[model samples]
Target: MSSALPPASSGQPPVAASPLQPVTAGILTALVGFGSTFAVVLQGLAAVGASPAQAASGLMAVCLAMGVLGLGLSLALRMPISVAWSTPGAALMAATGAVQGGFAAATGAFILAGGLIALAGFWKPLGRMAAAIPPALASAMLAGVLLKLCLSPFTAVAVAPVPALAVIVTFLVVGRFFRLWAVPAAVAVAIGLTLAGPGSAGFDTAALALPKPVFVMPAFTLEAAVGLALPLFLVTMASQNIPGLAVLSAFGFRPAAGPLFRATGLGSMVIAPFGGVTVNLAAITAALAAGPDADPEPARRWIAGVTAGVAYLGLGLLALAAAAGFGASPPLLIQAAAGLALIGAFGASIAGALKEEADRPAALVTFLFTASGLSVAGIGPAFWGLVAGVAVMTLHGRLGRLTHP
Candidate 1:
């Protein structure tokens, strides 16, 4: 038989040579999204005092939440509306460290943040207010939060030169040829080194079993509400959700904003009891599903979103294995991998923070204060950083008026 397409007999669109283009793109999106950030998610949860089992549960829960929401919304709206866990919020948590009530309080904060997101969707003014936060200050806070983590590669080299060099070299070489796969490549090398290194002695084979969700009854504390919840909500909205919408709009798909936010917010709340943090729109990975690479026709790209959801569910099944793998790795190795994954984000945030000269001074103040790691009366630096920036801006405005008068 000839290896060729059969001619269309009647009125119909030509069947493409390969029907799996969108499916391939969707799978790639899921792979890059999960492999690139799951380490950060685990590190963040662990930093907040979660046990290994709880971190695995959080990973599984977030994967499932994003999968369900992305699939459902894409089907309902007929648009490539991808969803993902809040990577920036997780980075913020990693920097925030443990709060007063520990992981339980962090769980409560997650719920509160989810509630705030849902409320923002329902009450337009709240959403607008969240949007109104100064871009410079917001970017500065994120950059500062990322500063320590982004420095992990050099620190890792100091701690373990051989393994760190291997990981870094892999990242650099692969990134030169395949930018999207760079972190994943480095992550793969780091995992292999962990298996071969002394850290493997503590590895527990039992942790490789299929994961069961671990529920932590939330204990709300004032410290967590201010330091963790508010900042998490702001970062997820400003960095992930808003940018995700803009990506889709750039691609010419304009779905109603309210329902999408509500869906992610509600999904996040539902999963919080099971140790999950925030889930939101996919910012970096959304382009994979929404772009022309997914499909020649924009209308049919929803299939890519659906495929990505299915792919995420499949990856969630491996959460336990992933946790086990990381458990065998040195903490610095994991940190290095997470940091490499975030280098692009850190650079972008720095650029955004300094974009407007008028906001530069306040942005610098915010960045320094946040990176200082100072705490006062139980509140963390992230919360106070915004306050410091605003105070400087106010003072500067008053001084300028006095001089002009």
Candidate 2:
């Protein structure tokens, strides 16, 4: 499990490193992580009935939590254990729509979810259960949750053809060469179009204000707990935390899971009352810092995480500006950028779900149900999708045994 980079073939040494390699990687990871999904987070908060101010508060809280936790964990563990807001959890919230008590109820559920995550750190069984979830089913559930948002680009193009197309084309072209820069490039184009488009006058630069915390007293309700708390925990664990662990393990960095989970969970709880939903280990951005590209020496890779954490703190300061920009821009433009950012995640989830032939049927069932947006009671399609997939997988296993016997 040595994380050392492979040695050069010849006697000559590898290229001399720039001191900025880790720093650059950290900055890139933070940029990609924040720019790619902050819009989606705002949209998710809105779907759950957050006022513009409340949503801004939530965004700020999560950003600060992530930055602080990421920095602390990286320094303590000396591993690139990047932390992030749960994009899948946000997507699940978006799918759940507004609950009985509206945003307050949802906030309560968020608190409960964060508490559950923190408890899971002390409860070995809970952590084990999360880890034991079939990879196919987990991946399928994530894919299902992501499907709708990923399609927003097309929807945006239909509603606002020229601007959406410009963004889309820019993404495709830039992604072809500099894959990492694709979403940022698209975001820049979308912003440019928004500033120049017909309704541009509505974006009052003077009105843009720094983000401030808008606390909402949480009111716990049965419906919100069942609908939001349970699903949020599941999606965050399945789609974000587990995958994040896997990414780190792939790079031969196996820090204790309980401490990591507890750190993020506590951070989430600290910010929940302020509108932060959940923060967890980051899967996508972790790879950028953990990889050899960040540092030739694996032990030194933690520097990238530390750098990213510092960068995230800077982004947190600009949360208000980001909120204002998204608020003033055309919804389609925001949707288009968010959708483009998630395209790779969608593809990865699909591939992960279908990688095993035996699990394909179950995975497809999960994806279909989740993508269908079916909600029974207050529970979202994501939870039901997991249920369906596991049921199918179990039945398929039993049938195979019987036939073979």
Task: Specify the highest-lDDT model's number.
Answer: 1
Instruction: Give per-model TM-scores.
Output: 0.93, 0.93
How do the residues 1-405 of candidate 1 rate in per-residue lDDT, one tens digit apiece?
211124446898755735788888888989999999899999999999899899999999999998899889989999988999998899999999999998999999999999999988898988987877788888999999999989998899988999999999999999999999999999998888887788376557776678999999999999999999999999999999999999898888888788988999989999998889899999999999998778877778889999999999988888887887777756678789999999999999999999988778989999999999988888889889989987877777732432234
Residue ranges of candidate 1 with Cα displaced over 4 Å: 1-17, 398-405
* Model 2 error, position 162 (Å): 1.0
Model 2 bad stretches (over 4 Å)? 1-3, 6-9, 206-208, 398-405
lDDT of each: 0.88, 0.85
lDDT of 2 at 254: 91
Per-residue CA lDDT of candidate 2, range 151-236, in tens? 99899877898888999999999999998888988987787788778866555564356789999899999888877888788888
Locate the minimum summed-lDDT window of 10 residues in model 1.
1-10
